[model samples]
Target: MTEALEIRNLHVAIEDNEILKGVDLVVKQGEIHALMGPNGTGKSTLAKALLGHPDYEITAGEILFKGENIIEMDVDERARLGMFLAFQYPVAIPGVSVANFLRTAINAHRKAADPEDKGISIPDFRTLLKAKMDLLEMDHQFAGRYLNEGFSGGEKKRAEILQLATLEPAIAILDETDSGLDIDALRIVADGVNSLAGPDLGVLIITHYQRILNYIKPDFVHIMLDGRVAESGGPDLAEHLEEHGYNWLREKQSKATAG
Candidate 1:
């Protein structure tokens, strides 16, 4: 069966403040879904909850991945199950080299998948890393640098992309990957994402603006309003949002609530 990530009536909260009121969505492998909304609408909260962040508690509902419930799983467990979240602001690991960080991660994944596995050999890892880097058109020297340490905004995002590539997760939640990027940087990052899109991955891109969507066309667009999904449509929805802001949707929502 094709791997899928399903969120049904997912209610998430941070401390006492509930953020995601009731979110329901499904992303299957080979699909690109965009979750768009203004600030404080719970887009990022949903991403965190999906990945089992301890602070963002899942008060209710179910999260199913590949036909298995993941609500009770730990963060690393969820990652091992082929779920990944690219943060809006990636933190720098000063002392860890990019290659070393990724190698460690891959080894962990290997150990999880099989207890008998000793992990990939260094020569084999280098070969795999080089292949992935070549596919992303990155220089070998880039791997020797510290992970995200003293890197530019574009380079930071690039490192995330490289992580995504190496991990090869079935479902990826990109939380505002377009933030802090200039036009050129955004294009390069989007190009990297576009190249990696295929039947093997299901991508959920969470963002507040349409600037990045112009480059990475989404198969589905969802709009969040006041902690719930108020609307869902094709790529035209994103275009409509760009053309005319969320006021119209807000008006419609108000009407529905009044009735």
Candidate 2:
């Protein structure tokens, strides 16, 4: 079966306020698409809704994964179905070690895929975890630390990317992964993402700035404005946004609305 994520005429609302006004998009495996826009344009809302966040209500629309409607699927169910979201701010789990959390998650996926097979053995799990950590350039000791607890901003983001690496999802949505990172940290995290980009993975990178694109070049660039995609083009479109900002797009959207 062809692996793809398709969003058709998605409309999302938080509380009584509608955020995403009719949005449509499709992401296939082995592709990277960057959704860029100013704050409050519902970039994050679209990402959250796609992942089935309870707070964001999907007033109308459909989210299809592998040609199946997944709007009703629970978050864990989506994760188990090879969908991942790397949050902008990773939450701290005070007691759970990174290794423990990943092992449990991996086992859950394994068991879901096959009912009879037992979860990965401890030694084997450790080896697999270590290999993934190394692929992300993370130290072996990093797994011993509690998941995101007391981790620096960089560490938290890197840990999120590590989870992405280990899970190897078919579609990964990065919600502002570059939100809070220094130059070095940004490069590190971007490099980690770059390393994981391949035929098996399709990534949706949501960001406000074009800086992150410099490292993980997107195959298509989309500009979101007022809860809808205003314009979309190749990498050059991002460079245009970098130089002119979103004012032009906002004006264009306004004119179109008036017309």
**lDDT of model 2, residue 64:** 96
User: Whole-model lDDT for model 2 versus the true structure?
Assistant: 0.93
Colliding residue pairs in candidate 2: none
Model 2 TM-score is: 0.98
Structural RMSD, model 2: 0.9
Segments of candidate 2 deviating more than 4 angstroms? none
Report the Cα lDDT for candidate 1. 0.93
How far out, in Å, is residue 219 in model 2?
0.4
Of candidate 1, the 10-residue stretch with the lowest lDDT total is 131-140
Q: What residue pairs are clashing in model 1?
A: none
C-alpha displacement of 174 in model 2, angstroms? 0.5
In model 1, the number of clashes is 0
